[model samples]
Structures are given as structure tokens and as C-alpha cells.
Target: MCGIVGFSGKESKEILKRMNDEIFHRGPDEEGFYQDKYVNLASRRLSIIDVLSGKQPIHNETKSIWLVWNGEIYNFKELRNELLKKGHKFYTDHSDSETIVHLYEEYGIDFINKINGMFAIALWDSKNKELILIRDRMGQKPLFYSFVNNEIIFSSEIKGILKYPYYKKEPNFEALNHYFTFKNIPAPFTPFKNIYSLFPGEVLIFDVEKKKKKQFKYWEIDFLKTNNDNIEEITYNIRNLLEDSVKKRMISDVPIGAYLSGGLDSSSVVSIMSKYSNSKIKTFSLGYTTFLEHKNQDIIAARKISNILDTDHYEYFMSPQELIDDLPNVLRSFDAPFSGAISTFFLTKLISKHVKVALSGDGADELFGSYLAPRLSQPLYYFEKIYKKIKSGYQLSNEDKIKLKPFENNIKFLENLYLKSNGNFEKWKYEILLFKDEEKKRLLNNGVFEYDKFNSFDLLKKDVENLKALDPLNRALELEWKTLLPDHVLAFVDFLSMVHSVEVRSPFLDYRLVEYVASLPGNLKIKNGNIKDILKKSLKGILPDKIINRKKEGFVLPVFWWLKNELKSFIFENLNEHELKNSVFNYEYVKFLLDSYYNNKENDFKLAAKIWNIVSFKIWWDLYFK
Candidate 1:
């Protein structure tokens, strides 16, 4: 719920102040700093819990160790009770933040393992001349650090580190190429050459005098095992765990709300939250122009749920032009090229306006096999068998070829084909049309991937094989959890919300909840081609039947229609040949894609993805490098 920054070795007060100032939106309530001979720690406070009592750079009575931390520690109260029993004294009764100094005193580096919350912590051991940085178990919070000339600089956002005097601006092309392949750069590698993000459940320790750093993983998810429990027992356990998770996240001193998408995940959270509150809970929903086109839009279902639950609800509708205008600012906030289309960006912005803290439905899809692709796998499995048998000694017809492409493209499709049964052809076609073959070749040549050293197809195949034990649907969910959830979904939420100084929490992503859901038998998750079966069963009485059985209409935006209408001029202006020629993409390819998309010869959502990536890259480049 806050932004933190610090630098050790050759410190400048001005640099620290600037870093903290840039992220004032994240923590406008209070600011704290600690500077000494070997270390400096600074924090911007959001004042979520213990507003008056909880302060950053807080320390034990003796003041030997200081802490600046972001994120909430859900189990802080329980930890505090244990600490108090062990003779640890406290000045305040805040849940999580207060336990840090005492825990560090009790267990030192081992204290991170004892924490069960989402946090990016920077602790300075003044007496020991050591500094430690820790990211939460699932990377719910971000921590970035760079080693620069006998000094280590770390911050909650890359922009904060950029404020330091000695930081460099070189782009990491390797990560850029990875971004092209995965649509998101993986952890430990960022867009910047030297800057790195601490992976989930990882910790970094630096010794100031020796100028040395080392990192180690503290936790990882094991999907291979399941709890030895019956379906009813598992369901009851899951309900209890989720209820506790939501209740803990609701511990805010300021006003808080829920992002109710009318989907199972968000509704479940809202339902549980309503139970614990004395009055109606506040909820927000984002809708689009496309909702009018569809018979079953999320808003309608959200309204039904809201009426039944009796929560105060707010809804916002966004136009394509507004999204286009906000693109540059949104990308700059991310400090990297993150292409989530535009729904994610606008949705976060809409919610940030109404609530300082909002709970989202991000992790539910990954945990409960809720994606359409996973639900379709059973049908696709039989279809693949029939197609194989009929194709002997004969080439597939043009139509058949198009239908079968997802199966042959790569192993990732095994999961995709099952989950949603939609092929990537539409996206790929748009991408191909956007640029000519020559442009693609040139981009491949200049891109982040080294074609000689690594074959993208082979690498994808290996990743698929690694998940052999998982069914196609489960594998896809796992991949999405590792890559898409962290890189695209979480990144979009973090940047957009933080831009308005709002904090977002996803209870579904609680490690305990994720593990429990993953351990359940797949049948409990999806049945009769329906996703979130177990979740639906659990919410039968709590939520309206209309919502419990509603078809999953994901957060939808009318981007395709907008590109042809309201956004045509805006898209053309930024993606013109002249603009693209000055950058890494080929101008001819960029022009072709725009023309194809406008002409409607093919669906060009994938082309839109590519375009968004370039636009985000350009915006990030201008902000940090220019």
C-alpha cells in the first residue's frame, strides 16, 4: 500500500527526496527516511492499517534496525501475539508493520520466511552493517534493485531508482526480445540492462563494506501434490481460507471497496465481505461500449448481485478515445512495455478513483480453471484424435488447415485449444498483416531474441513438455499464473492503480488459497464444460442464482470496433510510417497492419497487441531514456 526507496553508499539527500516525491500518490499520508554512514531508507506511507500508529522506517525501542515496507501482512496479528508471548515489546498494535523490527531482532534474515503477507521489505541492520530486501511469496508486491559502482539502489518502482544520480538508462534488448515472444519480460530481467526485479519468494542481502550481494528463494508452489481430503472437506476448507483472506485484507483505516465484475471470483469476495460488515459494502464495476452489443454483459450481472447483496455500487463506462488518450500516461506509469490491450488499464483507473484500496478477481481464473480454454479441452481432445485419423495420405483443406493450426503451432496450444477452443490465428494474422515479410525479418534480426542461439519454437516445446503431467487446461492455467498473471495482469493493476495512488489486493492470489484450489480434483473445478464448478457450488446460497450460473463474460472492451471508428485517427497518428521508421519496427509493416485492421479483411486483435507493445515501449523509452 506504499512505495519505498533507498540507496547505500555515496548517498545524496536530494536524490532520496526526489525518488520519494515521484511516488507520492502511492503514499500521500506520511513519508519517512533514515540516513546514516552506510545506509539510507525512505518510504511513502498509504496508512492502510494503524494509520496513526503504523509509520515507515519504524524501529524497535533500541533503534538498531529500521524497516521500510510495502504491502499488507495478513497474519501480522497472529505473529504479534506470538512475539508478545516471547517477550517482544511493541509501541503500537498495528497488525503487520510493527512485527518487522521485532522479528528481525528475533530471527534476523530468517524472519522473511515467518511472514505470510504480500510485501517488498527493505530492512537496514545498522548494528551489523547489512541490508536485506524481501519480496512476498507470490510477488504480489514488486521490488527492483540495481548494482551501480560499489553501491546498491532499490525501490518499489523503477522510476524511483531512476531518480538516483548514478543510475544508467541502457535498454536490455534481451528482455525486449523475450517480451516479443511472451508479451511480458520475465522476472530477474527487466527492460533496463542492469536493473532487476526480485522474483517471488526471493530475498536479496547486501553487505555494504564488502560491496557484495546474494539472493535465495524462500518458497515455491508445488502443484504435484493435493491434500488428502474429500471434496466436501476441501470445499469447506477453501471457503474458510478465502473468508479469512478477505477479512484480513479488509483491515484498512481508510475507505475500502471491492471491484465486483459480477464474475464468481469478485462476487465471492463481495459476498464474504458483506457478511463481516455491519453496513452495505462499496463496490465498483467498469463497463465498455461493447457491453451494449452483447446480450449478457458483466454490468447486468453485477447489478443483480449488488441488489441481492445490498452493497452500494458504482459503474463507469469508457470510450475508446479516452483509452487512446490515456495510453501514453499509463505506459509511463508502468516504466516498461506491458501490453494488456486497454481494458486492464482503464478498469484499474476507474476503480482507483472511488477507493483507496480495491480487491480484484485476478487469481481466480488461474486457480480454479475458469478460463474457457481449459473447459474446452475435453471436446478438443476427441476432435484432435478424429482429425489425425482423417488426415492420412491427404492434405487438409484450407478451412481444415486453419482449424488445425492451433494444434500444430506449439505445445502451449494444447492448453489454449482446450481452455477456450479458440485458435491464435486471428491474432497471428493481424500481426502478420501489420508488417510485410521483410519487416518481420528485420524485426526478428533486431529483436531481443538471438535466432542463432535460441529457437523460439523449440523453447516453447520444451516448456510444454515440462508440464506434461498437467492436463492441457491445468498447464495453460499454470503458464498463465507464472507469466501472464505476473507480467500483464498484475503489472497493469499495479501501474494504473498506483498512478492514482490507490492500492489493489487480490485475495484469490493468497498462496494458501491458490495451493488449496490447485490441489482440488480437476472435476471439482470444471464440469460439463463449465468453469469454476466448485466455486459455483460454494456460493449457491450466498450469491444470486443468476450470478452463480452466469456464463463467464470476461472484462470486455470494444477495441476492435473502436480501432475502425473512434480510435482510427489516434491509432494512425501514433503508428504512422514516419513514427515507426524512427524506431525498431519496420514502417511498411506498421502501415500494412493498420490498413488491414481498418479494412476488416481479418480480425487484427493480435496486430493491436503488437501495436500496443510498440506504443508502450515508445512511451517507456521517452519517460526513462529521453
Candidate 2:
């Protein structure tokens, strides 16, 4: 909901001001600043709640502590009421920003555990001479920090930190490798060396005198023991949690709306929102002209949901040219390479035009085992077991066999690795088959051909190890919550929405709701090969039957078709060997993929991912480092 930037060692006021000015779009309502010998904190405010008294860089009554915060504290009213009864006084009843100073006074560093909201809080403890940075439990908000020249600089966006003269602009190779494999840069590792992102549910405390920083995990998900709770109880509890989450996120002083993808997640959110609102709620959906030809677009279903819910709906059908035109800006907005580009960027832009804040259903798929991998778990498990038994002795020619023994072992290894890595066997197999010997040497420079040897796989394994007691389903859900939810889905949502200065809240990502649902048995989440079964049952009476039963269509773009149609020239122009030679990709392989797409021999989604990755790299290179 706002932009916050500061430096904690030897930063001039001019540099801090410049950094704050760059993020004005995030908070255009007002700006505040606090400067001292050791620290300079600045905030750009968007007046969402308590507009008048919410002016930030807020401080305690004693002026011993100052805080510049981003995001909404949904339970601030409850916290405020509690603090008031405990003899804490407030100058204005207008802002959640004031609640932080009092909460810190009452609970100290542990205050984060007591609050339920999405926030990246930077608390300046003048008395203790330490600065504490906290990211919310679900990482709905981002906090980027760098340690340089005996100073700690932190901001809401990477660009903000780049504004400082002392900040170095260099790509971290480890991060690039992770990006290539995972399609996203994992947390605690930014694209730049020395710059790091605070992981979700993490708190970083910087001690000035000692020149030391320490991080602690304040929260984590606990596996639900198999319970005998019946379907009725499960459905009832799910309905209550979802409705409560939606209601809590609806607290806004400005206009609010919902993104109606017409998919179960978005439609369910809008359905709950409509029931809470006195008037018809405004909703937005995005599609493309090519969607008419695909016969699988969700616009028709979205229209049905809108009509059934009696909401004011706005739909935008983007042309291929429009999507191509937005590519440069969208790529620049993301600091690192991403997988799904066109659809997420354009959809987010369209939603921002109508509403300052919108509620989304991003976390449902991860939480409810709704993706293809979770749905196909049984088949994949069987396939792995069968392959393991016959793989060594199966007779085939060298060309036909494809040397999958290494990859087969790799997939099996991933089963014991992390839940996120387990279902990626197909992708791994493809990577291995496509990864030429020369390409491996070119990318890695070292002789590291084993995918399981990567730090990312190890990190995943460590996370899964912590959840050893859970079943595969629960373990996988935990891994998604730790990895995919923050890295891919939430990162995409945050950057795209913030690029247009729109605040997006995910009701499904509410920690309480996630924990509650996570406690249910696996059958409640996915039953009889159906994903989100419990969610569908819970919404049976609340949502239209058409929506409840609609096949889950994710936010997918027509990348394959675009590479052959409207985007051919655009992609070709930027993808020549000369332009991409400096990138960490095989130019010949890229050319071959493009040729295959043009010759109608391949679905170019994977190739498009490569193209987008390189394009995103080029754009980010020019924007931040150039």
C-alpha cells in the first residue's frame, strides 16, 4: 500500500530523498522523512485507511522508536482496543501505523507474532540503537535490504536501493542459476550480491555497534494430524474461514474490487465479496481476441458468475499487439526472469486501472493441492515406482532411450528432496534431454551437471526434512507455501500490481485461513482425484453451480500462438545470437526452438519461456545496471 526506503549507516539526506521519489507511484498521497546521524527513513504514503492521521515514519509517544511501514494491519482495530485497555494512548484513532509503536512497546520483537496482517515493517529502536525489519507471515509485502560500506540500506523495491550512490549493481550468478531452474529467484537471495530479501515470517535485527545482523524465523506451518472430522464439519469450517478472511481484507477507505477470472478461486472471492457489500461489487476480467478461437477462455464463465452474483463487471479483450507493446515495461517491472509473462502482466495492469486495491485467490491452488501435480500424484507415484523397477533393463536404441536413467534417479531423489521439486520430473526430463554437453559447460562453467547437487534442491530438502512427519500431500503443500507461493505467484502479483500502483490482497493467503485449511485431512483438500473438493463443497450453496464445477483454468497466455503470429517479428528482432550472446543461454538451441515453432513442429510455450527469460534479463539489465 506504500513505499518505504531508508539507510542505516552514513547515507546523506539527498540520496534518501531521491530513492523515496522513485517509488512515488506506490504511495502518491503523502511523503514523510526521518533523518539522524546513523539512519535516514523515508515513506511514500497511499491513504487507504485513516487518511488524515496515518502519516507515517510514525513514532512512539516518547519519540524513542520510529517506524515506516507498508501494508494493512487488518487486525489493528482489535490490537488497538487491547492496547488502549492496557493504558496505551493514541493521538489519533485514524491509522494502523500508530498501532505498531504501541505494539512494540507492549511485546517488543515478538509483536509480529501477535499481529495478523500483510506487512513489511521497519522499526527504528532509538533506545536500543537497533533497526529491526519484519516481513509478514505470507510475504504479501516485500522487503529488500543490502549491506554495503558498513551500512545497511533497505527498501520496498530493488530500484529504491539502487538510488544510493554506494550501492553496487552486479548480478549474483548463484541467483541466476536458481532463476534458470526454478523460473524465479528464491528468497534471502536477491539478483545482486550482498543484497538480500527477508524471507516470509522472518525478522532481521541489525546491531549498529557490533555491525552484526541476525535473522530468525518467527512462524512456520504445522502438519495436520489425520483427523476424523466429517465432511460437514470440514465444509462448515472452510466456509467460515474464507468468509472471515474476505471480510477482513475488505477493510478499506478507498474503492475496492475483485478480479473475476471466472475460475473457482476468483469467482469464490467475488461471491463472498458480493454477500458482504451493500451494493453490487465492481469486478474486472481480462481476455484476448485469440481466446475466441481457443474455445477455452473463461470470459463466458466470468460473465455467468458476474450475472449470478449481480455485480458490476468490466471485461477487456486485449489485442496481440497490445500485449506485445506492454512487454518491455512489464519485463522491467520484474527484477528477475519469470515464467508466465504476458497474461499476468496485462491482467494486473487492467485490474489496476479500475481499483486501488483488489482481492485475489492466488494461494488457493498451493494450499488446496489444486495444481496438476497434486491432482496427478497417484499416477506419478505409480509411474515412478514402475520406472524404477524396469528402467535399468528396458531395451531400446540409444536415440530412443534418451539416457533417462540419471534423470529417473534425479526424480526419485526429488521425492525425498522438497515437495516443490517432486512433481517436476517431466520438466527435469525435458531439461536433461535438451541440455547439450556444450550448453552445460557454457552455462555452469564448472562440471556441475547434476541437478540434485544445486543449493536450491538442498534448500528444498531441508524444508521437507522439517516436515518429516507429514504425508506426501501435506509435505508438498508445505513446500509450495514455502517456495512457490512466495517466489512465483506472490512475487508476480506484487510486482505487476505495484508497477501500476495497485495494492492486491489475497484472502486465500490469510495465515489463519491457510493454517486452518492445512489442518484438515488430505481427503478434504483433494478427494477422488479432484483438487479443491472441499472448497467446491463449501461453496456449493454460496456460489453458482456452474462456477463450482468449472474446470480449473489458470492464468495462462497464448504464448505458443503469439510466437507464430503477432509476436514473431518482435521476438525475432530481440533474440538473434548477437543480442543474446552475453546471456546465460545457448543461442543455437534458442534458434532451433524458434525454428521448430515456426515450422509447426513444437508447442513454443517452453521456448517462449526461454525468450521471455532473456528478454526480461535484457530489460532489467538496461533499467537497473546500465
Candidate 3:
């Protein structure tokens, strides 16, 4: 799976083949290039591993280090046997992009701390003319750079750095006010204007003869560190680090499968990929034709775990007019304006017609305690242990009504999580925002929120104010691994599964199983109220207690009963007010969120998620700057 692009100043090599033909559907099998006089590099190859001489910008032997990767490093044959026992000269008999230019010729930019997977790389050295770039460490591949004039560029989608030619399209508007308060757009921000987002375990570097650049962070997932172990040794070390991250993502060459949405994170990743496959294991699930197979319990619990794991199963339903007729191919396969999980782009376009790698349980609910803002993390430490047992009035049971069921009947949302949660992260950032901040100050149009901090929960409010000493369920699972598990669920599952080129591998994003379920103790990743109760005791007896206690099944979409029946004139023909008049929304507050979503009458689903998040930001502002 590849699709990289390059640049590093004095452009022209025909703008790197028009920036590698704008991500040719993220690598249409093969493509490569590498330039000199300080970097040009390119790649598009989607021929999984070593597909006959695994080519790319790959280099080393006197080639002064060149590279081009996109992803899939599942420990490249144990980093090519420790870079072929340090001798380090290999071509391609088995290439993980040739152990990253011989581990950057023996750890020079500290070879991204001995590589794990999900990459973005670029490499290029031209003998220290520099030009690194990286992303992985569980941001699951997405690079996008810029720096202009004094050149930088980089790619792997932002339409391959908008084919540079002295690029200048401009739109950021503080990343569209954090995409209407984080429906997506929270990374090193980029809805254009000097493109950014190198984030996720970053690396930058640059310096093409001191035009300079540095950037940092080698890796993260701290969650205010705490591990005393024992819950049977953290569920036997989280089922032996998620079965060695699903056997190193089944180290692919081609067909692989497992998006089994029968809950419990892809049914414990298809029951450890049907106990390490040898056959009959292809599984996939999706259902919706407007619910009612008991709200189509996620394809009836994935066709009852495909008849209790006998395997080879498939299901499809969709229809809300084929999800509003695949809204312009799932909102133009996102360059931005993706409101995460749009049926993971029709279940990775039906697992790219049956597999080119799938396996995803996507970071087991931001590394445990499946969201309710991380099971409303120790709200006042379980509201002062049930407020000192009703202030010595004792006798409250059923585990004190399951620790007062997340502040039962919301007494002003538990008095704003008991007087605005400690060191106030604005009530756990308004319980994981989906648009607030007084409704994005009554639907934007307030002159580009003064060009910056328009309170999109103060963009991770200074990393949730330096995790204020953890235990608010590891500070809401370390601010959901810094903003919704890597800028909106691994950036819409790596831009909707490589825009249908398909290659989604998240063995619960193994950064050593997210640093051992983020060092355990968030009272065993949610207890009493039982949200991801330590990943259901690490799948007790390898599943089957009704699939390890089901229930955290999100990905439900009916869109508030199709915005008041059959996509109500297809959501006011892409949100009216004459196509958002002079753009930047506020059509009398999108007509008061479409008249309180069709005069209420019930089922609001957060006002159909803010009128389909402003009709998917006016179909991605009429598909990139109307």
C-alpha cells in the first residue's frame, strides 16, 4: 500500500509527475521515481510486500539514501534480520523498502525508534542534503507537508500536496473552525493554507542546505503512566499484546480479511483471525436498510459471528437510497470534511471486493473504556466514592446503583460534572464535542474566528492541560490519544481505506498494544459501569459469552430517520439558504438546525449530528473551495 509524493525546493522534474498523478487512487499497483540535487522522490506501488523486486524510490548502496514508502512495515522481517546482521547491503529479495535505507544507514534520525508500522516516510538524503518526513507510530499513515518557496512539499494525500507549482490555494479558516468543532480536522491542522499535518509520532527534519526544519516527537501514548499490573497481570499482558498484533498484520502479499463488525472490536479481530487462518476465514459485515433486525444489530451481530466462526461470511444492507446515493463517492473520498466512519466508505467498498488486507478493530475504543468520554472518567473519582456513601447514610447497593449510573438523570449533567470537572477540561471537553462552543458561536461566519483559536475545544486544550495527573480514566484515555484517536479515528481509517485501494490493519493500533493498554489502571479501563471493562477481561475465554458481552456497537446511521424521512429533499438539496449564500455558514443558524430538526417530534441524534455536520460542510465546500 503506497502513494507518496515529494519535493524539496527548486521544483521541476515536472512537479514530480504532477505530484505523482494526484495519488493515483493511492498506488494503482506500481510507480516510482527519485531525483537528485536534493530530493524529488515519488511512489505509488500498492503491490503489498515484495511483489517481485519490491520497488520504489528504494535505495542505499552508494545511492546516498533515498526512499518513498506509504505503509505496512509490520516489522519488515524483523527489520531485515537486524539489517542483515549490520552488513546492510540488500536489494529486494524481501523489501520493507529495504529496511528503511539500511535503518537510515544505522540509526541517524534514530531510525524512527526501531520502526513498528503504519508509515508515511519519504527519507531522501542526497548525502545529508537532508529531507526526512515520517508519520506512523499509530497515526496510521498520513503525511501532507508544505513549507513552500524554501521548498518541502511531501504527500500521501492532500491531493498529493495539491500538485505544487508554487502552490497557494488558501482555505484553512482555522481549519474551518476545527471542522465545526471536531467532526474531523484536528491534527497539525490543514484544510489548505500552507498545508500541514505531519503529526502522529512525527519526524520532519528537512534542511536542504540549511533552508532548515526540525520537528520532533518520536512516539507517545503516555496516559499519565501507571501500571501495577495484576488483573491477572493486565489480562495476561493484553492477550499477549493482541496476539502479537494479529500475527504482525498477517504479513500480507495479497488477500486478507476481517472487518467483522459484530462489535467487541471487530469480534476480537475475527476471533484472532479465526485462530491464525489456514482457510475458510473471510468475514465482513454491514447492515442498515433502516435498521429493525432489532436495529439490525450490526448485521445481526455479524450474522451471529458468522454462524459461530465457521467463517466465510458476508452481509450488506445500506439503503437510505444507498446511503443517499454514495454522496458524491463518500464526500469525494476526503481531503478534509470527513465526519469519520462514513460506513468506512461502504465497508472499504465491500472489503475491496473481498480483500487486499482488512483486519481492523481500530484501537480498541481509544485504548480501552469505550467512549462516554472514556466512561465519564472518574467523575470526581466516582463522585467521591458515591459521596462518602451518601454522607454516612450508607446502604446503597447494586454496586451503589452502578456508581450512580453516569450521574443518573443528569442533574444539570451532574452539575456540570460536579462543578466543571477538576482543573476543568470544560466538562471533559464538553463530553467529546460534536459541535459546541455555543454552537460554534451560532454557526461560524464571524470572520474566520479571528483567524485562530475559535475554541474547537481549544484544540486539545494544551493537551488537556498536561493530563493533570491522570486517573480521570487516564485523563479521558489521554485525550483520546490526543484528539479522537489520531485526528478522527486514524484519519478516517487512513482516508477511507486508501480511497478504496483498501489496506486497513489496526491490531488495536499496536504501539506495543498502545503501550500496554496505556499502562493499565483506569480502574482496569472502566469498571463498575462496565465500559470496556478491561476489554471485557481481555475477551474471557477467547469470546462467546454472547461475544464477550457485546454492547459498544456504534457506526449506526439512519441520519435522524433520514433527516425527517428519506433524506428530506436530500437534506435541503445540500443545505439551502441559497447554497450557503456567501459560504462560511450561519443561514439563520442553518435555519435553527433545520427548525430544531423538523420540529423535533423526538429522535434528535444530536440534531442529526448538526444537520449532517452542515451537509458535510456543504459537500466539502462544493468539493474544495466552492
Candidate 2 or 3, higher TM-score? Answer: 2
Q: Supply the global lDDT for candidate 3.
A: 0.78
Encode model 3's per-residue lDDT on 1-626: one tens digit a residue: 88898887654678899889888878888888877767788888888788999888888888888888888888888888987888888978998888888988888888788888888888877766888888887788888888887888888888778867779887877777777767878778878788988888889888898888989898877765676767888788888889888988988877798888788888888888888888877887777766555457777878888788888987766778887777766666667776556778776787888777788888888878677776666654666556545557665566555765665445346545555554255555665577867767778776633333566665567767766445677777787787778888777777777888888888888788888788777777677667778778878988788867867667656566666878888888777888777767768888887988788788687778778887877787777777
Candidates sorted on lDDT, descending: 3, 2, 1
TM-score for model 3? 0.34
**lDDT by residue for model 1 (1-626), tens:** 78999999866788889988977877988999999889888999988888878888888878888889899887888889989999999988674787988998998788887776789999888887889999887777889999888899999888888888788778777666566556567677788889999987888999999889889988766566666887678778878888888888888777888888888889999999999987778898887654454524678888888998899998877877678777778777777876654465676666666678888777787777754445544435544555444546444455444434334344344534433423332232122223233334555435432433433334344544555225545665665566566666777667677778788888888887877777666656765456787877766677778777877777656665556667767767777767665566666756666666667766567666666556666566566655
List candidate 1 stretches off by more than 4 Å: 289-291, 341-353, 372-469, 622-626
lDDT of 2 by residue, 138-244 (tens): 88899999988778999998878888888878877677566655667788788887888889999999987678888999987766545566889878888899999
1 or 2, which is superior by lDDT?
2
Indicate which candidate wins on TM-score.
Answer: 2
Candidate 3: residue pairs that collide: none
**For each candidate, what is the lDDT?**
0.73, 0.75, 0.78
Write down the RMSD of candidate 1 (Cα, Å). 5.0
